[model samples]
Target: MTSQTEIRVLEISPPESLDSPEAELFHGGVDVEFAIAKQERGYTDLCPSAEEVLVSLRSQKYYKKIRLAAVAGLAGAPRREDVLGWASIDLPRHDNLHLAEVHVAVRPECRGRGVGTALYSAAEELARDAGRTTILAWSDHRDAPSTRGDDDSGLEAEAILRPPTGIGGVPPDDAPTRFAVRNGFQLEQVGRHSVLPAPIDSEHNSALLSAAEQRANVPETYQLVTWKNRCPDEWLEQFAKLRQKMSTDAPMAGLEIEEEDWDGARIRDEEDRTLAFGRTSYVTAALHVQSGLLAAFTAIETVARSTEFAFQGDTLVIKGHRGNKLGQLVKAVNLARVLTENPGLKRIHTWNAAGNSYMLRVNLDQGYRPEDVEGEWQKRLQESG
Candidate 1:
């Protein structure tokens, strides 16, 4: 049994500096939540460190986001020990101004006691106040070994909720799925999370790269360019274009994300943030040697805490450049470079829309194995006249 009186939801103002007492307190709460979540989800590479969270809160270069936490303390800023759950409402400022992403997490022991509900309610109120029409949230689940339905198996077909894309499904009985359904949110899309064991045999990588190049049938004027940490001045403009295309061209299925605007300044900002988080990034671009412009690009970044893990960023082959295997070319080139550079990096994790067969095939060819499925849920708010 739970009541509104038991848990109080409060806004968490971004701290002035990470060294501040407030920062330490808030970080403690946030880190605990992440630890619990990682424990429940059984994924070590998915969660970010508390320092990363603080850095994002301090700077809103891309999204105007706010955090709310459910607490049980007296009338004041809640102490770290009093936090029962937290939620973040991320409002896109540039292109998708009407969309808000809400993420909620409650302590494992405090779940089912209204902590998550209180935090989500507070976050949703903020989004509503900002006039956001489409609210999106995500839930993570372990990947099912198979999505097949057998009449003799006892599990009914209706027990699994498959996205309209016809690629992935999630059990509706799970807590997260049930919560989303109960909150009037529909499971819009399912994305496959994959992990590629790293330090891939150098010989194997070379063979794949060779095969991709042969398949591309690219002109002798096409070449591969690699960089670390920062984009070169000469390629900044074209790199920005590739990123913008990635925003619009990527398979989104039924999600309501809009085309994002990216410029050289935004790219620089992102690079700085990645460095600030103590992570190193590797970038590979498939350049049209004739035009001196990037036609496709891919990025991989090392995890801050450990060298054994990294996350694959955007991999895009711009329009007019696809079907030539530019996607595989860049991905293979970048992976080979990163694996050789980070000897300790053991695995690289990535996600793709279930329906994105092109990129999925590219990833699978590079040895990426399915690790989990994530549901992107959305709810459209009615006009609040």
Candidate 2:
């Protein structure tokens, strides 16, 4: 039997030890009564599974700042013990500019007290200590407001009443939208998620190459080569430079996130992670030569397990003085190369912003079809606070 008393917040470091119970609880699903109890005691939301919690905790970005709450002294509670109810935030990687994403889980038993308020208070302190100026929280628009019919609903209601200062990604008709609106975050932009299926086998790839070659007007002076190793050092530099230029040049909404925002270290880290996950194969590069001058270049990585492998093109690019037809030629040759090497591949996946009609046309002509759209929701975090 537990007692109904004071709530306490504890900073649990390293997060790994909490995984088992967390996973068990999450998998078993929170009892509505337990959530209600927490809500009655003032807890707001539930934390995710221990595994996810651990990952967030262990990340170099947020480890030292993760905090949790133990609801103590609730009626019929386990003697001398409390249940974990909420998590605190301090994501250093985001710096002072980015607000921490707070996650809360209420034990059904402790709902309307002051557990959530306590947790949020601690989270705010943690953020301030970390030099953060804003708080970012999410909730579903369709879901009942945090305060709903509760005694302490006013506090819950106040947390989301301010305008959001910044927002990212598309808002589905789920928790995010509701949470933002209640908390004062305005919907900035609706975005979409896109996917490209795998590429076809070598036979189909060859046909695609032949067709593209027939249609493309790539100059004879340029030669398309597929390599099994890293691209030539100069080509690598050029590739990075061109990618930077293209990203800036591409039309999109909102602030332009600079190449510095996507530094080489981050790119290399991603590459390393991809290799560790076995998602990518050889890095492919295409160099356009004009009288021995490297006029244009492009690069791609082969994804073996991808659903897109069944298609004809993946990671296509054309850079520099290369004529418009060079894009098609490079894609065609690369597709042919990938097909010959991995005879079993079937489809290929790729993506372009909605505004990128030129690239879309090239892909369509090569037999790529429009798949589902991925939505990106944007919000002003400054206003929501």
Candidate 3:
């Protein structure tokens, strides 16, 4: 019901630097993200800074980035010159070329004005033109996180809807949920966002580390190796293999994603990108003593400016090494080192697919509590004949 004269959607290019004039819209988009997070989740801890967002847009060797913004100044004055919304379409370059990940965000005041729908329309058209057949998107849900530890405020079960995974649920009336369903995207999977308070008790950490090491048969058959920022030359290839496995080994549920293509070069590229974002990485991997191969690995990233929290990245135990508790072993060792080095860190945040019970259990055992739910939505586009 909106007219073209009210607003305009245009493709945007990343500014050369944060100080550039074109950067205003990009920074405005980041502000919108922070505002949305704070309004829904009561905090903006998960939102990245403008510098980080620009760094990601520039580092597109692995994924092609297309950004669009809706400007509300087409007519005369008043709300003129205001950025109403932002959208991004990411297309993988190496593997999963058939997929396009689309994200759209509108300013809180711009809701119900057709800004979001216009942005999405432009983004999806670009994806189709690029030959992408699968579109993927995610929505954040902060109300009534379905966890045993959290209370749902007497909400009825019938009002909640679970994805095909049958693990987590979101309220049917949530704005994001309704918009996605109206746009033909199916709820494919759900992920639980969790946080672990830091300054972990040294005694408790030691006890958990001992139990995990014993379960992993560490030192006897496997050894834990920890590093920061960069991987050692000797273990780069093995580490790259673990990174490759993370793509396929993780639960996909109904997503049409494929195994990612990774090499030592890609690993080094990612490390460089992390540094450019003003972040530091902490990694721990389990090395098989006899084979000298990395059987499992985990990583955590922290921003230099905010030493208050860290984000937990991928943690995976290769298929052959599943039952040995290597996941917990690497996570514990890496976390212990991170806490020691960054004494000011207050907490760590991580997300896992709702169906990934083993990893979820590992996180739970480490004292991570449920904070929110994320819905993974997917839609298949009709191929052009």
Which candidate achieves the best TM-score against the true structure?
3
lDDT of each: 0.81, 0.45, 0.85
Residues 1-92 of candidate 1 have per-residue lDDT tens digits of 44567788777887777678786457645866676757776655667777788788877868997988777754775577777778889988
RMSD of each: 2.7, 11.0, 2.6
Quote the lDDT for 101 in model 3: 99
lDDT of 2: 0.45
Whose TM-score is higher: candidate 2's or candidate 3's?
3
lDDT of 2 by residue, 209-312 (tens): 56655544344555565554334444555545544555555434442233323334444554554454434444434455444433333344554334234322
Total clashes, candidate 3? 0
lDDT of 1 at 177: 94
Which prediction has more favorable TM-score, 1 or 3? 3
User: Of the candidates shown, which would achieve the greatest lDDT relative to the real structure?
Assistant: 3
**Inter-residue clash pairs, candidate 1:** none
Name model 1 segments beyond 4 Å from true. 1-3, 74-77, 143-156, 218-221, 383-385
**How close to the true structure is residue 40 of candidate 3, measured as C-alpha lDDT?**
72
Better of 1 and 2 by TM-score: 1
Q: What's each prediction's TM-score? A: 0.92, 0.52, 0.94
CA shift of 161, model 3, Å: 1.5
Q: Which ten residues in a row are the worst by lDDT in model 1?
A: 145-154
